[model samples]
Target chain A: MGLQRGVCVIGAGMTRFHHKIHKDKSGRELFVEAALEAMESVDKGIERKDIQALFVGYFTPSLYEHQGHIGPLVTDWMGLTPITGWRTETACASSIAAFMTGVLAIASGWYDVVMVGGVEKMTALPTEGVTDALSVAADDDYEIPAGATFPGLYALLAQAYFKKYNMTWEDLQAIPIKNHHNGALNPKAQFQEEIMDIAKRIGQREGVTFKDPLDFLKSKYNRVIAWPLRLFDCCPISDGAAVAILAAEDVAKKFTDTPIRVAGIGFGTDTLALHDRISLTSFASAVFASRQAYKMAGIEPKDVDVVEVHDCFSIAEVIATEDLGLFERGEGLKAAVEGRTALDGDRPVNPSGGLKCKGHPVGATGAAMIHELWKQLRGEAGKRQIPDAEIGLAHNVGGTGASCGVVILRR
Target chain B: MVSGSAAQFLTKTFYDKLKEGKLIGCRCKKCNFVMIPPRLLCKECGSKDLELVEFKGTGTLETFTVIHVPPMRLKNVAPYVTGIVKLDEGPMIMGRIVGVDPNKPEELRMGQRMQMEVIEEDGKPVLAFKPVS
Candidate 1:
């Protein structure tokens, strides 16, 4: 919601997302991998010295990785020392928060070329420990003390959406099904196989006959971590990193003739506690952020050809589509059920799978979404490309919709 | 019967009564905001001039979730329903839902009337809600 200076992504990169405990690869190692890949993605090789500043996004590395001062550490590891660097954190939206800061800084004419990266090194802790670390993003005194986990919090939203819209569990299943279908096409996706494969494996292991995928999804194993949400609905705890190079629009042509311009950017925040929110079905932050982005881009929901929304939970994508104004209130699940958000539908969403399938590495997820959008808009997303995608949008949310960032790109 | 932790510190006399199927909230003298979970201080006015008030365990279901997977402590109780109930006394409380089918999303409607039932969990009386027909 400021001056409309143009910014373009010159390169993008990411490390393979996985559980890396014994390898001793820290968050900095992951960031280096992604930064190298991004440098390689550029047509003309970029020197480490060319990066004027570095922006890093991370969450709970102090707890999980036992490392802090991630900004300078990543910069030093990437051999971009002497360049100014800082870390931005907003729980899961850390990477996007960094990306947004880089954009704003460039727009303000503070810097010409900048590198943005997000990294999260979870999986070093046990499942319960991870849950406890993530719960810190909530209202610690009120929500966490009452035994509210992220899954339980989102489950409340899912239940409210279902109750208000007359939707069934089947409607929610459509999200995982669609995301997994797309994830299978992505080489870097965490869960690259279809859900039916999981079902078959479980059936064989348990010596029980699973009638179909639907039955498998509804099985006790997939049952809710918090009621109305099952294991399948949640994004996996992952360790990954992503990087993108942003340059002022005037010099963008020097990198790539076909550059995707940062058409719009918006961000908003809400109360940390769910109890203070007026509606459970929609996030006020996302609505406000998307509006800001749309207004800045001089576009509307109708102008968006493709979207990559935060599907940290399967239900999140449903609420995001509605909150982004892609569909009217209480109609997001219906749109999803009707396949309107499918790859070949009117408005393709999450073509690179999503956080649900592509894996959510907290800080990395926001930058990863932008990386996917960059590839799609440049017509480089093989097998998962939306046809003639002139405009694309990315929505990233942090901690049960407490913080949200929306970015729009135009080719 | 209260848990060892609750028994270790009998800070509020009403907490002892809550274990006997009594619903109690704290009313602040300044703002008159009733806290269902019974806060030590008023959230609105930050007043410690609080008094305990018994609440009728009746309300409406504002929202709810059918938890298919539970935490390790509640693993045996998978497929349980939990919800935020807006009590008649003007306080929202999060608790488990009893006497309902978790799989039946159709049955869990918002604004549906609910009545509270106190169940023993870890030797402590835990309050829950049940849909009223």
Candidate 2:
């Protein structure tokens, strides 16, 4: 069902997503830091007490921070206590769910202004611990017990998609290369170096020369994490936070004259386990959510000018693009390899560098995507800005596409 | 969601039969819809009338992956091949592909006939698959 009144995003902010950067900062600290930045970004400033309620999305505070009940903790940290707050968890898409909740809160005439965001502090644990933490999002009894790690699970999809479409792994190289390029321009991205630059730097440091990007990717340093997904193809563990401020459309002018309207919002979920899905080649959750958002917004995929997708892996970007109806089935791979998704391309995808470069802080990823869309829609993206960008879409997915959220924004 | 045997499906009996090298799944008597590892109710039609029927122990390899980095439980066998198979009885199930080089995943062809067998690992029976010659 559609909302009674529209919700518009007036301000958005995020901390630099990195692995070791936010070492001493706790999840709540990161949340407050991002929240303060978002508050300051509004065209016309608003006070903290003006925010009616808080909705925080944190995937696993127990695993990372050894803390639970993070909703109250975040509100307390922001000094907005007793204003009503709740936490959302959907593996990686946690923050998007929070954003959707905040939008509905405004649309229902329940609250005129709401603050929503997510935070993930994953560097507290070892790499193996993070992998295990992410894997539990799948069906515990079925997938996890059978030695199914996230990469291995996605590897199965990559294999099946490759076999069905007669594709090779070489086609995937384009995605990382492109993301790295856009990330190079993003000041806040975790990895801001181009793939070729990284290759050259690593070659010099290791005293091993490389001919090109592909050659460097094949080396032992970039060794395989899974069968087809190399280390370069996977997103790194990062700690960061992102927040967005939403206000009712009629009352939005008080906060910001340039409010980007949340034109459409949609959410969908499917069976957690991988085997239960009818088709592994595409994410049904993404398709269902995107279709609902497109229908509600009265716009097709082609109407979207710039987009950001949940590219947890290179293959995931392909699947998300096709599932969102941005590209045809089996055509996403070719689109990636042909640079059809480049920053300056026809349908620019992930101009914010996506999860591969902008960094995936689990809970904060969704709000970070919205932050990028807010920038690009306002003609604020300095180097990666799409010319004449009017509308943008953000697609965030939880573990293995089990949960999905698609939001369409218009400037 | 698959809480326990109290649901009448997704119970220990599914794995118990596998120890004897028997493949069984839930088959809907009314709709003739079959599912691997059994289920309390049919997902297609919500048919509660179901029976455990022995499968032919054969299927086609739908997809597979070689896990270089396994979970904490399977750390010993770090690099192993696990796959999804579309059974002859019309259900997709997860099984580790045995009798093949895990590193050379390309050798595992899709749509190739695979024989299902129950293999004991750490004193627990798990469903596995091998290329049928």
Candidate 3:
């Protein structure tokens, strides 16, 4: 069944995703910063009392900050108490769940206006600590004991994909190259420099020159984290937050004339461990979730004007494009190489630079994807904007495809 | 050997059998579905009535990766090979792929036959696989 009542996002906001910039800020402070920006983004303006309730998604507060019970704490911090608030989590897809929860609340007609957002204070912990914390999202008793890291898990998928498609690691380089190019245009992106520029800088410091981005990528400086997956292939550990203010259709215009409607939202799950999945090249969760979303939206993949998919690893973007039906299976890598998924390409994926260049603050990533789509749909995405973009989609995955959520939005 | 009553498809029980040089899995009586690192219920049909079965400990290498940046727990064993094995009985599981140079992952090929090996890590049995000529 479709939503009982129409729901739309009137405003969205996000802090620049980075590791060091937000170091002095706590998760609560970062969340409030984003929420204030969201409220300010409303053309008609809004107040704290206008929000009826709140939903927050934070993946690992306990391990990262020795904290829990974030929902009420953030509500209390925002001074919007007693309005009913809680936390929702599905690992990296946490904030999308929060966004969906807010949509459901508005659709239920229980609350006309509510706040949905996510926050992650990942920089508090060291890299190894972050790795150990994120591993909890996998099956601790099984996958973790088998020595599976997140990148290693995706690398296995890359291996299977390469063997199945007659592709090589060289074929996947187009993804980071394109994303970094897009990231160079997005001021909020953590790495706002093109790969070649970065290569030139590093080359000068090391007294070496590179012919192209590929040469720099293949160099020892790009050192392997997992076979076929290098440092540039992964998203960095980051700290930030993103927020979206949602209003029911009737009252949405009171907030903004160009409200982005929540046309379709879908979520799905598969076996937690990678070995249990029927296919390694594609995520069953992405297929199921995107299918549900497309059915609800009554639109095909071609109708989507732009997209923001979870590219936690470079290989993931290629797989996500196919799973979401943007490209045929085994054709995703080729599409990336041909620039079909570039900013100016027919199918633009991750114009906001995705998690790779955008910096993935896990819990905040899903809502942050929404933040990018909100800008694109409203014609506010500057420089990296997709012209005449009316319909946009966001795909977020959690824990090696154990959980996934897809949201489709339109102007 | 552990008592039959104590074999309830628990992780401890699965590893205990691995400690004894045996790889035991479970098959659901209702759906005839088998799983390694066995579960209390069948994933296919959700049946609680299950029977323990031993695997031949052999399968094909479906896919593999060499982890260069190891997690803190496995730091001393950096650059270890891990892969999924499609067991003969139809269930697939993850384990270390040994008997090959981790530094030379190019030597590995998909669909190669492999045999299971139980190796000890921190005094506890851990599952692994090795290529068979």
Best by TM-score: 3
Ranking by DockQ: 3, 2, 1
Task: Provide the lDDT at A352 for model 1.
Answer: 89
In every candidate, what fraction of the native interface contacts is reproduced?
Answer: 0.39, 0.53, 0.75
lDDT of 3 by residue, A1-411 (tens): 689899999999999999999999999999999999999999999999999999999999999889999999989999999888999999999999999999999999899999999999999988888988999888887787778899999999999999999998988999999999999988889899999999999999999999999999999989999898999999999999999999999999988878899999999999998989889999999999999999989999999999999999999999999999999999999999999999889999999999999999999999999999999998889999999999999999998889999999989
- TM-score against native, each model: 0.85, 0.96, 0.98
* Cα displacement (Å) at residue A383, model 1: 0.6
Candidate closest to the true structure, highest lDDT: 3
| Model 2: residue A392 alpha-carbon error in angstroms | 0.6
What's the best-to-worst order under TM-score?
3, 2, 1
lDDT of 2 by residue, A1-411 (tens): 667898999999999999988999999999999999999999999899999999999999999889999999999999989998999998899999999999988898899999999999999988888888888788775676567788888888888888788888887888889999999999889999999998888888999888888888888989888888888888889999999999999999999889999989888999787788889999899999999999889899999999999999888999999999988999998998888899978889999989999999999999999999999999999999998799999999999999999999999
Cα deviation of A338, candidate 3, in Å: 0.7
Q: Which model is ahead, 1 or 3, in terms of DockQ?
A: 3
lDDT of the candidates, in the order given = 0.83, 0.89, 0.92
Q: List the residue pairs that clash in candidate 3.
A: none
